[model samples]
Target: MQNMWKCMEDLDQYLTYVGGPAGALALTGVAAASAFYLASRPSPEAPLVPLDGQSILQNKDTPSGPEMIRVSKFYKEAKNGKFLSYFHEDTKTLYEGFRRGAKESNNGPCIGWREGPGKPYIWANYNETLLRAKNFGSGLVAHGLSPGTQTFVGIYAQNCPEWVITEQAVYCHSMVLVPLYDTLGPDSCSFIINQADISIVVCEDDKKANLLLDKSPKSLRKLVVVKEVRPATYQRAKNRGVDIVKFTDVELLGAQKDYPQTPPKAQDLCTVCYTSGTTGNPKGVMLTHENVMAALCSVMAQLGPHKPNKTDVLLSFLPLAHMLERCCENAVYMVGGAVGFFGGDIKNLADDMRALRPTVFPAVPRLLNRLFDRAQQEISGSCLKRTLFNMAMSAKESELKRGIVRKNSLWDKLVFRKIQEGMGGRLRLMVVGSAPLAGNVLTFARCALGCLIVEGYGQTECTAPVTLTVQGDHVPEHVGPPVPCNHIKLVDVPEMEYYATQGQGEICVKGSNVFKGYYKDPEKTRETIDSEGWHHTGDVGQWLPNGTLKIIDRRKHIFKLSQGEYIVPEKIENIYIRSQYVEQVFVYGESLKSCIVAIVVPDVDVVKCWALENKIPGTLSVLCNNPEVKQLILQDMVAWGKEAGLSSFEQIKDIYLHPDPFSVQNGLLTPTFKSKRPQIKSYFKPQLEDMYKILM
Candidate 1:
């Protein structure tokens, strides 16, 4: 143990001086050194399962639930479940699944992207896509990889067709894939590589490669540059015994080599997806071929209209590293649909959306909220427009609740048609996931957009889906019933006062969709998946009246105040955000504080409007610090809290309104657009402390 610690220290120090592939090799040497030391020692008793870290204990009995939901149930119960017949499910492995889908629609255009707005789209048909995947797989073999070798491949890129090809190649060759999000920090990139023991990495560009170089894991042996590599990078990698190759070269080499005939097995390890860790180090969720298959099958069984068709086109902008986007890509491929990649820039997503005119769009809440906010801005531009928009929105909401729509609806045609047309007129469905969608966005989209909005709840551990809202059953608050693949039940969370018997408790899921375990972490695996094969999700949920699940709060995020009063910060924050005066908020309370203090970022547009309404003159910066403005916002927040039924102790006592909003660029928001509370608290610790003192 002491030797191991010394070696790690040496490795860390050594890595600071090295750069590029050499740095990665130097880091990998530490693992080699540890292996050498272990080899020299006297042999210890080997575990029964050959000690690959998984527990050797026999499987236990399954837990009791309200009968596990099955595909047949989905077919019988879902609103448009008959569409399940179109799903290609005879194949067990993802590679085979892709093959069957591609074969069924060989010459159809599949993936597309453009250089910029008005640029002609570059496309690849299904036949071309499959050929490229095979060539990429052959390239892996040419690079001395073999099927069933437990090789780990890392894809460190943003959303691109190459990302999809590389992913499919890795799976086709039966290698485990570790996806590193483009937004991840250098340290996180290294941590994932080390945790997954990835030997080869395909980076998006030279800058991303350099980021990996700063903290390159010792396990990394090769760097595959997708765009281009600098000469210095090549030299650095060469010096460190790392093989650096261009993606095109790999494909060319693979085209000359024989492709592997053996495909991935159903239970084969598919991916090691590391969670976007908020509080601590991210854990790698080990998903299998079976797990992904189950998730895909379940989605098809539930979201009937979502099954893509020949004419269906999708806009892909979200980070492909996210499971939701990845699963959507797979589903699109299965149905022989087209996916139009964004123009490699988020600032241009709107232009891309308008140009592509996608029929299917999968979005996170942040994007939807932005659209809603934009509509509000336009509507509020003129009093007449505001009144008309409100009338249209209200009428549509009524129509939605009544479960009916009129052909060539007058309100929709006059007031909301422009909004739909602006978003490329042909949108049929928008699937929202990754985080809870705001209620206001749901209400507005349902009435104004005239497109189906499906909001669902899921985590990475369950292959990105466990429950989802189905077509024709748009209960925005409830994340539809558990999908066909899993059985879900509630378990008591005593400390948080969540009770299973009362239909409110921590959600526990069990089925093929549940992950095999966390990669290389048996203790964490045991903690997550119990003896009864249930994955104990830390989220709290209650059964909705319609037999669906309503996620309330996180069991792990509830913190007790100084007075021993428990506070669910998310609930309070959500309530406070309902006020148009706020943009973003972080609720913080230490153990010594009797009341919570908030860090708020006011909505500049709304606040400016308020200043105008009250005949106060100032810029946003001035208004943010104005005592009168602060008091006005505080009153609204308090009112919102009271309306939410929060206890007095739970109400935010004082606030430090921040001028800047919480964003991914500032390390305050995750890639999914969820607030990173720990980072935010740390960033504003001094301000929060002063505010708490004032409250005291």
Candidate 2:
């Protein structure tokens, strides 16, 4: 242990030196961390499977309500003696039963929608979709394929039924589905499929098909096309004379159906949504059948979980390639709820939401933040609504502080009622996850919509949900206690630490719901999981006095100051980004020195606000490059960064504000919102030189 400690200390220093020229600045962060680690207490073992963290927590304090919140019951319709689970009467289990019902109801008064262009969700669960997936599942399975049969089945398509159906079909048949984001270019997409040993290809368009054939391995046994913009791409794929065809052709060959064949048992592999890391190749996260199902259980364990019913409808607009949306798809299917698909484009999302009038929604922080900004803009535009909304929001915040959701008032009708209508009159809840949402966004949502807006946190590695705050139990400071059936532990690392534990070190988990392991990488699996089976999530977290977990930041990302105060850059950045003008921020200053610095990107719409105010705008895109706008943002960042993050290390030493937003097309941000740290740093290396020169 002593030698091990020495080795870790040496490596830690070396990392500080090697992280980049900025790494030397992290020396203060390291010394502070070392002292803090010495002062913190030893970590306790994470509770075992039989034990419930929530139960232990509540018992220690004043017990909360029911031990579990079951969305399973919501999935079924009430009947004579026994209720039918979310699907048709003939259905057996929650897994296939809902799908079966959906298939039967297809083209039977089922509807599809997206009212206009720039509308996000157009067709979520149209009749043709369910029917196609049922056939699609059986078709692929007939080829002697199942989940985990090959490493992956690439679902590369635009936002359409083909994407959803192919994903479900892959899930039903038990093949590890890797849904590739369309925005991810040919290089990243091809690399992921190859890394996962994708056996079956469900390419959406001809462009993707051509790209696949060009770079794909000879071992790729089957290729099927779905929706495509250019027909020539298909001919290109066919001319390869290797092995590939359109999806329709695959369907023709797979005519028979042993439908719902052995619904994937809990232990089976589900999907592997690869995520960006401090990179070598992107890691294929192994999520199990039960891992997904456990997400429902954990959600139910929270307050006011999803309520699935025939009348309930969900807006499927967020990228289905994402886990939160994917899991919502499953939960909605189980409930026999209608899914309204938003158009592929984000610009179209708002109109789509209004037309769908969806009863439920699962959204990312980015979406929620946009909504918040829009509502604020809407209010600013109308004085009558603005005054009422401000007063209502103030009252709502007070009630929420006490965990009491106040009854609706006349103010809602007079002011924000249309806001709710735009989201669909049926919206009972809008789950916000994927990243930390601004507190103001949360406040505005609860006040404006009067619908439940809960937050959750997870990664592609955990199959998308680990902790969530239920509707009634919404705690603002912490994310939430661990969901039921999840064993969340803070492992104490005496050497490399960030979360004080107030004493614990690394956050760890041991659960059947944990992924089987990274696909085809035994060494990586061993490194992630220890001898006792705990998966070491590189995140740093500490237990609050109330027993809830507060995540500090990625352990590797946290740094310190001369006072031994470890500064969590992401946390500080999350606060800085709360500014309405700031779209995104990347904090820099690892070991080198005293203060933090940031690279800032202004929100397009927010910048338009400035143009409108000055009466000097062309369009949102045009106004982004306005020199005056750039100068305004730089001044704002200096004040906003320091104020939000506190002083000392949190203060911005200098900033490099850019008119352009980071995007995959531009090679700035990953598909996931994580900034490509090295890529961004390199692209702006010269800018950093200017920043440091000025700061010094």
The parts of candidate 2 lying over 4 Å away from their true place are 1-131, 141-148, 211-214, 228-231, 242-244, 256-263, 304-306, 377-386, 402-408, 495-504, 558-696
TM-score result, candidate 2: 0.65
Off by over 4 Å in 1: 1-89, 405-408, 558-696
Model 1 alpha-carbon miss at residue 178, Å: 0.9
Q: Write the per-residue lDDT of candidate 2 for residues 200-275, one digit (tens) a residue.
A: 7776666667666777555465677765435665455556554556677555555465456445555667677665
**Residue 463 in candidate 2 has what lDDT?**
64
- Residue 203 deviation, candidate 2, in Å? 1.8
Residue-by-residue lDDT tens digits, candidate 1, 556-663: 766544322346688788899998899998988763345688999999999999899999999888888899899999999999988866657678888888889999
**Highest TM-score among the candidates is held by which one?**
1
Candidate 1 lands at a TM-score of 0.71
Task: Give the whole-model CA lDDT for all candidates, comma-separated.
Answer: 0.71, 0.58
